[model samples]
Target: MPHAKTTPFAMPLPDALAHVDRVFGIGTILADEGQDIVAPYYVQSEPGYKRVHSEKGCMHMALNTDGVYTADGYFTQIREVADQIRQVQATRVLELGSGMGFNTIALAPDHGQVTFTGLDLMAHHVSTARNDAGHLPNASFRQGSYTEIPEDLRGADVVFGFETLCYAADLDAVADQIAAALAPGGRFVMYDGFRRADFAAAPQDVQTAARLFEVTTAVTNGFHTIEAWDAALRRAGLVVLRSQDLTDASIAGLRYLHNRSARFFRSWKYRLLRHVMPKYLIRNAVAGLVGPYMIEGAGPRSGDTMGAITYSVLVVEKPR
Candidate 1:
């Protein structure tokens, strides 16, 4: 895959922004098997994702099944997440990029005996998560870069690195940081997108133009094959517990919901970007590009093609 033409000039270059750990673990995550992977999207700046995920319509797909914002469904989904975590028996668990702290709230009961730390890269996200954590007694919010998170995370019973990895340029460091932060016997729960089983004709501009929809940038470094992600996890001293191809299930579901919720899919939120910014420059423009895609007139770059459920999810564990 071709690297981005323009490298970001930020302190923790997007590559380094993965997780803020000063030191790295000794073992390496191995991609012994070669699998061609592609990150579904890109972003020129952080605003790229904030605009779309924060939006009312397009956001449901990103947050609900993808693990972005709080669920619009009900406590059942939250319970499902808790079931996954409780089974792990994580005493000190940390979620890497908790957007609105929904997961934190959902897992609040677990935190009664479980110490949870929710870390986020965005300021508003941290503030909102902190506000969400305000009522919780065990959880705390921290405003820090993933690149330098402290060693306190080293022995966590459950360490999660969800789809948020896609935003990092260097997945190696991301893996290193996660491994270093894990408890010797803890499990590393990972859920990410996978490559399509067959090659779909892609636009040469898929990499560049896709950045127009920045929300995809946060969880997916790019669309990767299950094999590629599997290899990375193994290399980092973690073993795959269970993984399955959910591509078909997710795609089918998104298409169903999208069609069913077509009205909300184009709600007034679609036309209100100008109120927030100049509308020409910023994520609004990207949202405009994504609008048509979500509206059913997809020209290959449609919503069905670029969502979280589009890929498979996995659960990997760090052995004692």
Candidate 2:
């Protein structure tokens, strides 16, 4: 069962689904006619993502290794981000959208000199992360949006997020906010998926899937293409230090998700529920959790390359 906190919503479907269906080559469902799907809350806070992490006390979207569902793989992502922070000798680190404090708690003990402060949008997530990181004195968490960096939170030596910025309603706003929060020469590192620059030029089927993935993932306006990312960073007056496409490396974990979804869909319990529950509910359940992954493949694929999106690591530095 999904985590109890991961509540499902049946909002009036917005006009976005048709575009999604057209992009991904899927037929429109009757579910889109009246009540559509929407997740007003954070995607990481969703049942599927949260339930898995609640079991092991860590939640992250990036894969640590091929076929590795363990928290270790997630930690590998944390370590990479942490390593980047360390290289720049940042003593004050801010993690925007630090869901459940997994990254904060994981990196705090290892680098005691660097104070890790996590800011999240959900109060519940703040509480949960604080409880999880209670033993780590170097770690702290607060409830807030990354788009609006409070004055006192400014001047961080390093700021980062893993698949978090996609929650922003305005990527440009987020870029500007990060720039304002960091000290001169401070670094900002992000690991997230982005649409390809030529996504619109992709084959019709790929375009539909890309749109579907965006709507289903609740990142419709927030998911930026790589080209958009560069422009946004530069516009915010931050210099791009490095941008590495980790799409291939991230595929293993995605494949694992596909396998898991296949198992769940094939389960006898789910089969029985199909007849017992309302069709819309089932559709919402799958659309909320499974559909995004299906369109995106097991991992990141370029918009024109057949996958819904591609993942990348972008490191930028504020001018001194």
Candidate 3:
């Protein structure tokens, strides 16, 4: 229920669940841990945001959907929400914060007769995204949370949840659990963290405290503007089709993914594994100055914290 400026953390969520179970498997917990998630501030905030946005801007190493992303190759805004959910060829689909499964294997082979589910709340990353959905076959996985409402996702048809609804503190109970699990007039695509005007002309308030003031994860940011997601989609009955502004194409593909993630973090094989790998360290100076302040300078970036992508992405509809 953390809203009204959520900054409250007494510290410690890492018992590391048996060190994330005797050192991850399931391809390094859904595809590499990216330096044990930047060494602290609970891996850059919000109850370990499912392995930090599924390996923060997964440079397409997110189980190959024809890979390539150095961050902000947000799989081309998840391929325009998988071509509008494969032109609604959906039968049953659901995803709500299925991080580390990278859009549940990039929207599960384009709705393989749907029936794809993936919920999450650190149920061990939904048991490592069901072992990274290996054989795929009408995928399945659940850990529950959207305040737990299963019943075969009611009438599911389409419901993808990106950027995990700004770590929902309760956006009208997660938009009434995506309008009671769609299917009546299903449709619910997403993208999160909206509040623009160039992120309120950046005077710094995008927080997640370790000691940079504080505000770990939203308690209230239901699409902070875009007229607050059209008044939270008419108070969760949903009905907004086609909405885009991939925030200036995600700030020009995060400027070509912060210059190819600073040449893959200064390659010489990752600076010789950050110099003789002590587990390729990271003590976060704002995610190591966010790939060298967005690829080595052009000035004023208000000292990078991944320069907040300022967002919006919608398909929404649910009221037959």
Candidate 4:
């Protein structure tokens, strides 16, 4: 893989903090309760995600393996899911928090023999996904929460969630649900931002950036550590197959969004629009700008590599 030309955390920690404070009152950002905000946040953020993230309705970060950001990078997680489907010869696939059905819809057409069901907390998201997937008879979406996978949806050969598991209020509970939902020998895959094991030891600014990113993105309580997830999954009797940090692969895409978000802060017109836009929607800029810092720490000039969060993939299996 080629190295990213754009460096992570190119913006100094102090500068990033000040920018966040200016764009969103620091106190207001900190005061957000984060409770019951997931559905509303997605509802408010749908338009922005469509316009900025991907018109195809991807609600997750792009993984730019080639060191350059492109719309195609959004397919990285989908590609991984496809690989798992093939590996397991998955006849039934279940996606948790399947926002807009991007991954399922993308995979359904190619895997005509597979049946894909997406469950999301928001009806609007399910409706949107269902509408987008109307042409694909193999794909279907319904409004539901991963906290309780429907009995009929259980026994999936492949279960995956992209960036949505962070909103899980109870990791152990969700893990149990996932484990139960999968058949023996089935694979469970997830890609999301995680708190590093040593997150507490990271610099204060980096921690702040991570919190801001989490809250702004509706992960209000903060992201769970990879260690926590590993333990939770294991306790639920799932065997961990892979736990790899892919933060570096995410830099190019983060930088791309950061630069785009920076434009809002740099110009008065964009700043003015923040007042009129939905609070949660406009705050996405704050998340976009500080995302790299949370993952990569202070800039190259400072030589600080102490990061508080990581973008990672976790794959587990229910033993046969």
Top candidate when judged by TM-score against the true structure? 4
TM-score quality measure for candidate 2: 0.77
Per-residue lDDT of candidate 4, residues 52-124 (tens digit): 9878799899898787888888999999999999999999999999989888999999999999999998989
lDDT of 3 by residue, 109-128 (tens): 86677678878766556766
Computed on alpha carbons, the lDDT of every model, listed in order, comes to 0.47, 0.64, 0.49, 0.89
Worst 10 residues of 2 by lDDT: 4-13
Ranking by lDDT: 4, 2, 3, 1
Instruction: Compute the lDDT for candidate 2.
Output: 0.64
* lDDT, candidate 1, 263-287, per-residue tens: 3223457335435543223322333
List the candidate 3 regions with Cα displacement exceeding 4 Å. Answer: 1-91, 96-98, 102-114, 117-156, 164-184, 187-191, 198-315
- For every candidate, C-alpha RMSD to the true structure in Å: 13.0, 8.0, 17.1, 1.5
TM-score of each: 0.61, 0.77, 0.29, 0.97
Q: Which candidate has the highest lDDT of all?
A: 4
RMSD of 4: 1.5
Q: Count the backbone clashes (under 3 Å) in each candidate.
A: 22, 9, 1, 0
| Model 4: lDDT of residue 188 | 98
Ranking according to TM-score, highest score first:
4, 2, 1, 3
